[model samples]
Target: MWIADQWKDYEVIDTSDGEKLERWGDYMLVRPDPQVIWNTAKKHRGWKKPNAHYHRSNKGGGEWEFFDLPDIWQVHYKTLTFRLQPFQFKHTGLFPEQAVNWDWVCGRIQKANRPVKVLNLFAYTGGATLAAASAGAAVTHVDASKGMVGWAKENAAVSGLTEAPIRWLVDDCVKFVERE
Candidate 1:
């Protein structure tokens, strides 16, 4: 299987009992992952004293339990920066695994001599949009949630892409595409 393992800010420290111990920057987190079906040995020290843990609820949703962790933290991929926080549904507003995709997209945009127009659907925290903009592409970031769009805008601003050609749109991607 192809692995997206080139990460400077993220790592899967260990997996055990349907859970994963990961390090996001300097903070360690324990969270459930269905992909980790193996009940392996959890000998990692991070597991013993994680900075945060996302407890999955049997009813429907889950909650984050914090231990000396900040409400938000920053991580960088190349020159792009992302504000991460343990939010609902066990999300830190960033996905380090998708950095490879961002790199690939940026490469394609740079290869194109002419101006490139990119439409990023479900643009969570503007990672791809920022990457496209950094690569000199005009990007339109779209997400159904207004908050997500706002977060993406924040990411853009932080990445020095605030003056770049980026439009944050809060619209259903399917409907937006149909209208387009």
Candidate 2:
């Protein structure tokens, strides 16, 4: 039961009725969760006045109803910063839940006491890439979407790792690995 409790910019304020209310930095958002089967009372005030709400449709997909949201935002975890946006499929560009993994990856890299090279596949928005780079590891970040690769680069720059050893690649992971 790993919890990403180290986050100061993100938190799950409450969960009820197949939905979880989350606070991403200064904004609150209501998004559906399949695992929240309990129909508990939504006691949190954030549920009433969220910055945005993602309504899941029974037919297939869903849409976001925005109140006071922006096209882009930023969140921080330790020394790293991530650019976030509410995009397709109810996804924020950054996954706050993955902070535990980022912490572990940073710890392992720092403990190595030598130069470490990491290959991050499907590295969306460069969370792990930035963590590894911050820990002094040379990272190769690859993703199929050129836009996502570009987004990862933005995250890297925002985290002040513009001079860090990171190689950004936009290609299919399998083909990239096969060629390397």
Largest lDDT belongs to which candidate? Answer: 2
Q: Per model, state how many residue pairs clash.
A: 0, 0
TM-score, candidate number 1? 0.96
Worst 10 residues of 2 by lDDT: 87-96
Give per-residue lDDT, candidate 2, residue 140.
97
Off by over 4 Å in 1: none
Cα lDDT listed for each candidate: 0.88, 0.92
Q: Model 1: how far is 92 from its true place, Å?
A: 0.9
Pairs that clash in candidate 2? none
Tens digit per residue, CA lDDT, model 2, 1-180: 899999999999999998999999999999999899998788889999999999988886899999999889998999998899997888999888888999899999989988999999999889999999999999999999999999999998999999999999999999999999
Q: Cα RMSD to native, each candidate?
A: 1.1, 0.8
- Tens digit of lDDT per residue, candidate 1, span 1-180? 546677778888899898999998889999888888899778888988999999999997899999978988887788888888899888889877888898899989999999899999988788889989999999999999999888888888788878999888999999999998
- Model 2: CA > 4 A from native: none
